[model samples]
Target: MPDHAILTADAHRDLRVNTERSAASGDAVMSAMVVPDELRQVQNEYPILFRRNLEHDRFTALAMFGFEDGENLFLEGTRWAARYLPLSIAIQPFLIGRPEGADTGVRQVHIDLASPRLGSEGLRIFEEDGSPSPYFHAVVEKLGMLDAGYQASIGFLAALRRHDLLEPLSLEVPLADGSTHRLVGFHVIDEERLRALDPAAVAELHQAGHLMPIFMALASLANIGALVARKNQRLRHG
Candidate 1:
């Protein structure tokens, strides 16, 4: 359960967030939100896909970590097995929320006080003098980066929509125990459509810096094999 509250130095002076990778620390996740800026590096280790929100009619890019809910194949003991961690996962227990009566663009930091990661011991968020600590600064920086990345992603997503390049995807995996899992509700880049774009559109996309991420997202499909191998390894070891 989340007990979300505004993050303030006075109220959360003794609060700290655990950085370890474990279920108790809220690091056990199946997927994390991804942005265009991270597609190149994230595509190397995770499959990048788009998830649509039926209510809002919007699409969000995600980096798949596991085939099933509550399963994170990259988690190994107290450390994540991946060389790069998604910014969304790294910024756990902290979120950007709207301030009361504020307009749409107003964003404020909110903390999940009930998160298992919250404890008395860990990186201090505030010093004894009620000043932000180094850890706090780092978190703020990362949060800012996340905000900017999301803002920039709007243009990238619009570009994809304009070209009708998003296509539904279905994944089927055979496990070691002879059971197969079917994954759905995700979308991917349509490579054929992308390649078939008119030269003028291609040049426009290239000028907008969206071409690399499109290819990167398509390339991430190769990591699906690695994910399956990891799941099978876990099943055999268990």
Candidate 2:
């Protein structure tokens, strides 16, 4: 559980966050999360797919970390190997909160007071005069970008659904130890369907600036093989 509190300069001026990366600091295996604005970068490192929210019955974009739960192939001795970390992973311990009884459409930043990352020697949230620090400003900017990116993703997902371009994916992988791993309940862009799209629909997607991301998501499938290779390497060495 997270001990969340609205961040204010007056109350938590001296708060410092630990920027270290290690499992002992609670940085461990991570599952896929939605990232809308990082399709190109994410495609280079992680396999982008769609996952169903069982409760909501809605599809969400995911960046696969490992073949199974609690297994992160990107974890290399506490350091994530990927050059591009997902926005959801990078924004840990802080979340955008809605202000109480306000209607300006502004979101407040809330920090997890009990996060392992909180320490005595990291980025300061505020200066001695209660002014926001540069680090805090940067985090705010990032959060803003994250918000806009995810908002844009809503339409992107709707368009994909409109075109029926998502299809269920089932993967079977053979490990080095002569064992097989089966993965299910995931979806991917139906390349055939995408290619078969009517020209007018393709033109509309192009006009809407969603064509490239679709291609990037399709290209991200290649990373699944890389993930398998990393998993195999870990199994062999460990």
Candidate 3:
């Protein structure tokens, strides 16, 4: 976002705790809260960004990239950790039945989002050395990418709407360790009304021409209530 069109605030309520790093950085983790009372008055002053899972119908997420429990991904200065609905079907090529230590680099190129040229071929390295870590492999074997994008969009909306953007909400998570974290934050997204962002941003993104293939593929994949599977698969989220 451009500096002129942005507002910065401190928050800690909903950021998801990264157990992987939390072990070492738990004491370093800081938190903030999005002031709801401050939001109601300024809600209309900015464009509202509504978010929804291209796959799941129940809750919608903002478009910001960061932890669900914390303020900004920049705080940790690492790759983002997020979830989405359509991602299950979108990333099947590299995630399914593949060995460990695999990286497709699908996200490295800007155009990759709208093209079919995804990650490097091969399995990813399994980082198990008898030590249980907090970092878990977030695989869809299916997809949650598009929903992630949608979620980010929602985040943008919230940031624009109120000075306080990050707030805690409930997430019905099923952890691998058989232990559940209650009251996980899933930021708010107004499913119905969202301001239309600058079309120029998308136009500039695709101006390169090479990135066309992936979004073209995504266009077909993102459909409402769309369900697609591997081999015998079909598109689900719209």
Candidate number with the higher lDDT (1 or 2)? 1
Colliding residue pairs in candidate 2: none
Pitting candidate 1 against candidate 3, the one with the higher TM-score is: 1
lDDT of candidate model 1 versus the reference: 0.90
Residue range 1-238, candidate 1, lDDT tens digits: 7899999999999888778889778878899998888888899899999999999988999999999899999998898998888888877788888877889788898888888988987888889989999988888887888888899899999999999999999888999989999999999999899888999999999999999899999999999999999999999996
Please, what are the lDDT tens digits per residue for candidate 2 over residues 1-238?
Answer: 7898999988899988766666766666546566567888889998998987889867788888887767788777758888987877787667788888888577889999988888778888889999998888878887887788888888898899899999999899999989999988899999999989999999999998789889999999999899899889989998
Candidate that scores best on TM-score = 1
Q: Estimate each model's TM-score.
A: 0.95, 0.93, 0.19
Q: At residue 82, what lDDT does model 3 achieve?
A: 23
lDDT comparing candidate 3 with the true structure: 0.27
Per-candidate clashes, comma-separated: 0, 0, 56
Top lDDT: which candidate number?
Answer: 1
Error of 1 at 23 (Å): 1.1
lDDT of 3 by residue, 1-238 (tens): 1111111112111212222222133212212211222222213221112233447533332222222344332223332222321232223222222124656433211111221222232233123342212321354311234334443434333343443322334444333345433433344332222223356643543463312322222232222112111101211221
CA lDDT scores, all candidates in order: 0.90, 0.84, 0.27
Candidate 3: residue 196 lDDT (0-100):
36
Residue range with the least summed lDDT across 10 consecutive positions in model 1? 87-96
Candidate 2, which segments miss by more than 4 Å at Cα?
A: none
